[model samples]
Target: MASFPKSPFPKPPFDRQKPQDPPGRDADMDPRPDYGEASYKGSGRLADRKAIITGGDSGIGKAVALAFAREGADVLVSYYDEHEDARETCRLVEEAGRQAIAMPGDIKDPTHCRALAERAAEAFGRIDILVNNAAHQKTFESLEEISDAEWEVTFATNIHAMFYLTKAALPHMRAGASIINTTSVNADTPSPQLLAYATTKGAIQNFTGGLAQILAERDIRVNCVAPGPIWTPLIPSTMPMEKVKNFGAQVPMKRPGQPCELAPVYVMLASPESSYVSGATVAVTGGKPFI
Candidate 1:
């Protein structure tokens, strides 16, 4: 019955700036994202569940990690060497009275992806949810500006790694388990500047739909979350400064979404309440139509 007021939309325009690299830090961003640190009240929606989330150190992944912990689920936070961010996420998870495991490695490597699943299985005894949320992206003016290596790296990190992790985790997952992948709005409306990244997201949607059917008999669910321009470190680190300043203006809401806004959808998809919901793409795109 208790509720809180929602944050107003169309956030004040951000100042132009650039972040460090492919995977940026939450602490370094100007006006850090609201990852539901002081909010996100939970009521045991995923009690005692065990989940593995890639890119769980910051951004949407971190938000989901915190939400899951608050909802009574133990979480394994997989990240790409962002030790401080990962530690902070783990601390928050612990504060919620849930266990958190921080695993730092590149999911781009299939071997490392399998190792992540193994580590989660070893620590938790079983895997109830798997969120493939880590990604790589860069902006280019023209097709010629995108190199062969960049294209391959993008696919490896975005889509290939999801395949590897899913394959490794399927064996450990039981009926009623959930697999949530982080796709992008670009899957439906591709961004020319992000050719490689968008292509991989498109692949993720197709993969989610196909996998859901294959696992139907086992009662495992497969779904994806498609986000629009979210106020995450990845925006400044990958896009041009001008683009970063006006990140979410193109969306109907005229403001970028915070990572926290996307966490509840993940909670629902991973909850038993969504047992009948699979092979679906849930879009959290700030009032933007996903179809």
Candidate 2:
């Protein structure tokens, strides 16, 4: 278990909060996510590699996209609807001197997921990295309160889409390729209100483990990133305003992490620096304890 300080970040602005989607956004977030693009620079660690990232429009996905671009990876940014954020990410990718392709669609659809894989392959001539970062969550006070529809939607967007995308992309991925999934801290110590969402995350953990073993033969690594509370649009959109106000207070870091803090971990895992690392789950939870 990791340790976290029990303090909250200073509130940014309540009026600035808005719901963009299930995964939410940095644009309407109160304090807005820090992408750390200015500090990060590429040294050709992933030069010529092609990477596809879902939910790359905002939050952690956006941060990862920027870092990958900085590391010399041509990025394919996939998102649900947030065209504006997608555009911003694309601009940042170009600013980093890496190619970025914006693809907007619902990952919940198998066809869309397959098409995204095909598009990525077409864009870069090969698929080297796939980051399953898109997810959906809605609060429920009790397990009984979770509707079948909600559960289905959560699984469809979170786990099923990962399966679909991987199936499509794996055919094109050769040796040394990587697949990273974005799990959550809830998978270990779940929040009751996010039962459905947590369940899908747990499934993703197991999926990562199993797929790692299966792909080991081909030298294709599979892993997961489990994040704790960080200041992102998801908190304001899904939690009550009062809860949102105190978000990340339970963590050892006292304040929620900026997205920039999470970016380098992705870079490390995707780079040859961590060539021996795979079938692992790296936690960036502001010192939140996890089992």
Candidate 3:
């Protein structure tokens, strides 16, 4: 194996800024997150594979798409109307000499989730990897502030969509296939402010564990990724300006992780290199232990 230089991580004391929506744009972020465009040397770990990645428009999802492309996998990026961000991700994947399909729709809808899988199969012949990474989060002072609608929407977008997409994609997945769900540090240490989001993450972790065992006989691997405070557009968009400025201070590293920082872990899970790895929650939390 060859050694590669590490990408630069942003220092503490970030400037306060916010995007207008729940899922923010990468272009709008002040200190743009590193998505391994100029780094992440690939050795064809996922050569000739086909993958579907929800929320592949930006942030952690985009980083994973780029890495998968570089490793020789064709990707289908599913996002929720982030046209520009989705296009940019596709462009990066294409630049890596792989196919990139950008499909814009709401993953919260079970119908749409199934359509995404069908489209991916139609475009790529087979689905080798399925990454349920799209998520929704909002901050509320207390439970009283969280409405029933808000709670339902959170579960619909986060956990339910994962179930829908996985069910749809399983038919296309054969032996040695991989399914990677995006859980969060909140699963182990829930954040009261993000009550709905945290709860869904907890469910996702359990879902991954159960699904892994259920599919073991089929030779399919299932796992999840739990990330801590990654410097993504989601921070400025959903969190308060004050919280955004000090987003990752609680971690021992005292800085939020960059999306690029988590790409390698995703690539490993998607590749044959992790054939023996399953039912595991790989945490990329910048020194924050998931346990």
All models, RMSD in angstroms: 2.6, 3.6, 2.8
* lDDT score, candidate 3, position 197: 98
For candidate 2, the per-residue lDDT at 264 reads 83
Model 1 stretches with alpha carbons more than 4 Å out: 1-6
- The parts of candidate 3 lying over 4 Å away from their true place are 1-7
lDDT of each residue in 1-291, candidate 3, tens digit only: 999875368766787675568798878777889999998888999999999999999999999999999999999999999999999999999999999999999888889989999999999999999999999999999899999999999999999999999999999999999999999999999999999999999999999999999999999999999999999888899998889888888898888999989999999898898999999999988898779
Q: Is candidate 1 or candidate 2 better by lDDT?
A: 1
Put down candidate 1 lDDT per residue, 180-208, tens digits, no spaces.
99999999999999999999999999999
TM-score for each of the candidates:
0.96, 0.93, 0.97
Candidate lDDT values, in order:
0.93, 0.86, 0.93
Give the Cα error of residue 21 in candidate 3, in Å: 1.4
Q: Write the per-residue lDDT of candidate 2 for residues 190-234, one digit (tens) a residue.
A: 888899999999999999999999999999999899998867667
